[model samples]
Target: MLLADPNNPTGTAVDLDALEQFAQALSPECLLILDQAYCDFADGERAGRGLGLAQRLPNVVVLRTFSKAYALAGMRIGWCAADPEILASLEAVALPFTLTALAQAAALAALDQEAALFAQVQTTVAQRRRVRQELLAMNFEVPPSEANFLWLPLGAGRLVSPSGARGPGSACAA
Candidate 1:
């Protein structure tokens, strides 16, 4: 089995060529499990990558949620694309009904407004760039991000408030 997060913790996305290379490197019979929870945030036109991989590689499985980009975080609904055997296994262990009525309705509404919400996503990305630049100017070792949140590592397990005081590690996570 192989697991891939094209957009890793650093928010770097794999292009179609790279994705194809990764898939080709694996034995066709081996399983490729892709957790693409944040994939839509990755800017680019790699529309056919996942579907292409699934169509060509029988052992590949793609799991996506009706959350995140859809902003339907409260919905427990998710979808998976894979070979029939893999889908059957999923069905066997799947819960009776993971999503409630309201969640389903919310997901549908979100889909209806996906475009408008995508503009919001673009705004968030733009803000991420501004914040990253500010952090870099302050001599922070911020990774070049391609996603929503930023991760800052405090080497000494410390924290700094806007008031300019340093504290302990627990404060950061909290």
Candidate 2:
């Protein structure tokens, strides 16, 4: 399965046992493509350390980006972990020079502060909890979010934002 953001507008994370079960079922037959673009915020317990599923499943593919956690949106820097066959397929279809020299350098630089970055993520988690609690107090059907942005299920009030109803395919860019 090609999963982007994994959960949804709900911001909920797939439980570890659930994900592992899903992967184990498909192993040796299908590849589990897990895209964790907004994973840092959703992993409240940091249960996956970002790769819990891929780590345990042989056919699982874990894709991650620096845009969310490391704040490297413009660089388009991300990595995919998969079996050798999938990796080769990806390379074949990937565009040449997909990343600029500067982008490459920046990703390398970001790696130097992994621990500090992780600490910040922990701090962000606390903030998300506070924000969710505050919103819930207002009677909004806000689910506990795992991403930087909260998931306002919106319910019958799905049409939010000052701009009126965002189209089915549109997303809140900010």
Q: Report the number of the highest-lDDT candidate.
A: 2
Query: Per-residue error at 69 for model 1, in Å?
Result: 1.7
What TM-score does candidate 1 reach? Answer: 0.76
The lDDT of model 2 is 0.75
Mind giving the per-residue lDDT tens digits that candidate 2 earns over 9-107? 667777666766767877486877887877876564543443656666667888888898889998989998777777898899999988999988999
Candidate 1 wrong stretches, greater than 4 Å: 2-8, 46-48, 156-174
The residue pairs that clash in candidate 2, if any, are 41-146, 42-146
Per-model C-alpha RMSD: 4.7, 4.7
Go through the candidates in order and give each one's C-alpha lDDT.
0.71, 0.75
Please give the distance, in angstroms, between residue 8's alpha carbon in candidate 2 and its true position after superposition.
3.7
lDDT of 1 by residue, 72-137 (tens): 776777677898988898889987867788988887787799689789778877888889899989
TM-score, model 2 to reference: 0.80
**Against the true structure, candidate 1 has what lDDT?**
0.71
The worst-scoring run of ten residues by lDDT in candidate 1 lies at: 40-49
Off by over 4 Å in 2: 43-52, 156-174
